[model samples]
Target chain A: GEEVAQTPKHLVRGEGQKAKLYCAPIKGHSYVFWYQQVLKNEFKFLISFQNENVFDETGMPKERFSAKCLPNSPCSLEIQATKLEDSAVYFCASSQYYSGNTIYFGEGSWLTVV
Target chain B: AQSVAQPEDQVNVAEGNPLTVKCTYSVSGNPYLFWYVQYPNRGLQFLLKYITGDNLVKGSYGFEAEFNKSQTSFHLKKPSALVSDSALYFCAVSLRTGNEKLTFGTGTRLTIIP
Candidate 1:
């Protein structure tokens, strides 16, 4: 069984269109984090959730990016008005502890914006 | 604020030879370090972590890392390299604070020569 699951493994959208990615963290895991991998081999911190509540939203772009982890539903990361620079692989991960623990990641959702 | 640095852009090792990937970090208070491997177009796979206690920690695929508190470094090492080990390696760190997100390095590409 896969510990973390991400849906829509690959997606394509034209500029100005909206894009959304979903993640299901491992059961019993309380901490979930999202990262964006850009073409320069850089991993940018996006946001994180502790259960259904957000623990950090510092890295999220307030104008276009939003995420939510609702009770009994998968965590979602949504982007409005996609831009060419937004094309990247978005990773979702979960860990038992925020301080010191192994964070397991899903396969990632690949977004291609034109 | 916490941050990780992988000084090398790439590392090359011959099969059966020893390999080392360097990582250094800066953070307030005690640090939690982690190593992850990523193949092309895939999510990161956890390799190992150093929370506390022992300076040396063994992890998946015969890999290990040495935690040097004085140097603020946690470098990934393997006694014997394999061609299959070719991938992108990431070093990450998190502060002792319980709700912060992990800060990841840019990533080091490892090429194992057969």
Candidate 2:
């Protein structure tokens, strides 16, 4: 079995277009986290999920960024009408415990908004 | 809100010498501190974490972190640096529980000069 995996390691999207990234967390992991790191900006929490349920999404952009963690399926983070500000490296991490311990990160999906 | 600060944008160290990457955290509750390393164009790889008990936590690749409650710092250190140790390092903090969201520093690029 492989570790956490992400698809489309790189993505380029025009402004006003939609972009989606996918992540398959390690098997038996119950918690998944998403983060966005813009150039020179801190790695900010975008969302977190416990199984198929949303645990936290306070950092999500109210308008367009959405995410989902399906049961036994790869998780997804979709950005609609991408803006230049949305361009950044999006990372997905998973942990077996709910306590944010022993988390593992994926290769990440680099999104370039043009 | 929780956050982390990596004071140095880049840390330069000579191979075979000791190295330190400074990190400080601001969080409301007891912190679950972690250190991760990333190579160029790669995702973060967990180094070590400070959950409780020991102040000194040892992790992968000869890297370690010391969690100081009074200083609110969780600095990563390496006993003897190697050229391969050069990479981008990130410090993150979380609440006691795994469900809590993680807050990461901007990151520090460590360059071990051979």
Candidate 3:
């Protein structure tokens, strides 16, 4: 089936350790997005990429979080210094177009910072 | 800022009965509303979307949503509920133009009693 793929379904890191999650969008999809879900609550928008170029990142928590979608590699969300609050599920999504009218999601990567 | 609201935290219904999940929004520009369903450990699956035109829009499964501009609501409804429909439902909104990120509301858990 055509679906987005994410790696490290579950990850555990020390409080100060760095954590990185990856996602591969469906083939031919042009836009990719990242979102954070904490305690199974509302999703928080993190960033979006239009074919490797960042489109919007206003909701991103700067200073510790950064993401990129390289030409040949999968998109990655990396936390420079993991914090307890950063323990949550990170989902990656993709859409046929940039408007994200019908974006699809990956299974999500669960990150745990202790 | 674009935002979505799902007032009920959970909704209970019996199989074969009609079901409705409420959602409301606030946006500066025209709104693009969406509904998604999430099973256990899986990522969100697109159910329906309201972009333009008709006030009533049908989507995947047996679900449909009415886009009421005057009421500022896009409520999801299904004629007959199924036990398989039990899951976490989310309502989201995005700018019809420009912004591509989706702002999601706190999810509503739907349980269908068989």
The number of the candidate with the highest TM-score is 1
- Name the regions of candidate 2 deviating beyond 4 angstroms: A98-100
lDDT tens digits by residue: candidate 3, A13-40: 9999999999999998888999999995
TM-score of 2: 0.95
Question: Each candidate's chain A: what TM-score?
Answer: 0.96, 0.94, 0.95
The order of the candidates by DockQ, greatest first, is 1, 2, 3
* Winner by DockQ: 1
As for lDDT, the candidate ahead, 1 or 2, is 1
Candidate 2 lDDT over residue span B55-114, tens digit each: 999999999989999999999998999999999999988888556777789889999999
Q: After aligning candidate 3 to the native by TM-score, how far in Å is the CA of B1 from where it should be?
A: 0.9
Of candidates 3 and 1, the better by TM-score: 1
* Cand. 3 Cα-lDDT: 0.92
TM-score of every model versus the real structure: 0.97, 0.95, 0.96
- In terms of docking quality, model 1 is medium
TM-score of chain B of each: 0.97, 0.97, 0.97
DockQ of 3: 0.68
Regions more than 4 Å wrong, model 1: none
The residue-by-residue lDDT of candidate 1 on B5-51, one tens digit each, is 99999999999999999999998888889999999878999999998
